[model samples]
Target: MYSVVILANGLFPSTEKPLELLSQADKVVCCDGAAAKLLMWGREPDLIVGDMDSLSDSLKKRYSNIIKKCDGQEDNDLSKAFRSCLDYHPSSIHILGATGIREDHTLANVSLLAEYTELLKDIDCTVDIMTDSGVFYSGFESMQSYECKEGAEVSIFAFDNTLKMTCEGLKYQTDHVIFDSLWKASLNMAKSSKFVLKLNHPAKVIVFICND
Candidate 1:
């Protein structure tokens, strides 16, 4: 399968898992300032995408051939890089450097995972946001199972507070809980090697599983 990795302008990953994935990606796409980070790490980006506002003139001139300038106010640089990845028709897309440093940007990028899931569902492409702490996945309201290490941290978030859900293999049961607040069902732990989530209706939800 064609796998693509997108590096954003957030904190550059220094952890082992994110770094390994970045180094192993078939194609590494950078978003404006992230191009400089990739180069400093001794790896060249296959494609640099953004509005060109964050990049320096010398770096732009040096990598002009590989840069894709997307000047639009509607989407951020990370979004532009993701849209560009669609042209490659990759089977899977992994996003890194999308969290930390700025709290606002981190939250926005995390929420975009849900939007990306909606956009790529029909195309059968998997998208994930990998952070220094964990990995983020967006899915619809359904019975979803995730294989993870025992005692791993798990958190679920949804835009609709009325949405009810249940889970198996979690330290705390979620059947009787109302998701009125974003932190209502956070900081959960897995009791087994895998956990299952059963949603009450068809709605989008974001799940985060920390690295083992």
Candidate 2:
């Protein structure tokens, strides 16, 4: 399976898990200013995407051949980087440096996970946003299963509040919960090493699995 890593210009990753993923990625794509951070970390990205505004002139000149100028103002740098990765036809995409620093930016980046999953639904590609504290996954299918550790922290957010869901292996049951609120089923814990989420219909859900 082909794996692609998209490094955004958020807080630079310092944790071992994210660093390990970056190092092992089949191809690494940097979002504008993130290229400098990746270079500082002593790794090079296969491609640098997004508008050239945040990149240094010297670095741009040096990596001109690998630099892809995406001048779309509608999409964020991370989105641009993600779209660029699709050309490589990756089976899995891991997003790093997507969270931390500004809370607004962090929230925006996390919410995009649902959109990314929808865009890749027909392609059968998995997408994840890895942070220092945890990893975020978006589910578009009716049912989804996740491997977890007993008592591990878990948070579930429904992109479509009207969507009903029932879950198994979670400390708190979501069968009777109303998802109109973002935190309606959040801060839950896993009761076992595996959990399953079954939705009433097709909907989008974002699941956060903590590293601890």
TM-score of each: 0.96, 0.95
* Candidate 1 structure quality by residue, lDDT tens digits, 1-212: 88899999999999999999898888999999899999999999999999888899999999999999999799999899999988888999999999998999999999999999889978978999999899999887477778789999999888887788989999999988787777988999999999989988877888899998
**Candidate 1 collision pairs:** none
- Clash total of candidate 2: 0
Candidate 2: misplaced stretches above 4 Å?
A: none
User: Judged by lDDT against the true structure, how good is candidate 2?
Assistant: 0.91
| lDDT score of residue 93 within candidate 1 | 95
lDDT of 1 at 170: 98
| Native-referenced Cα lDDT, model 1 | 0.91
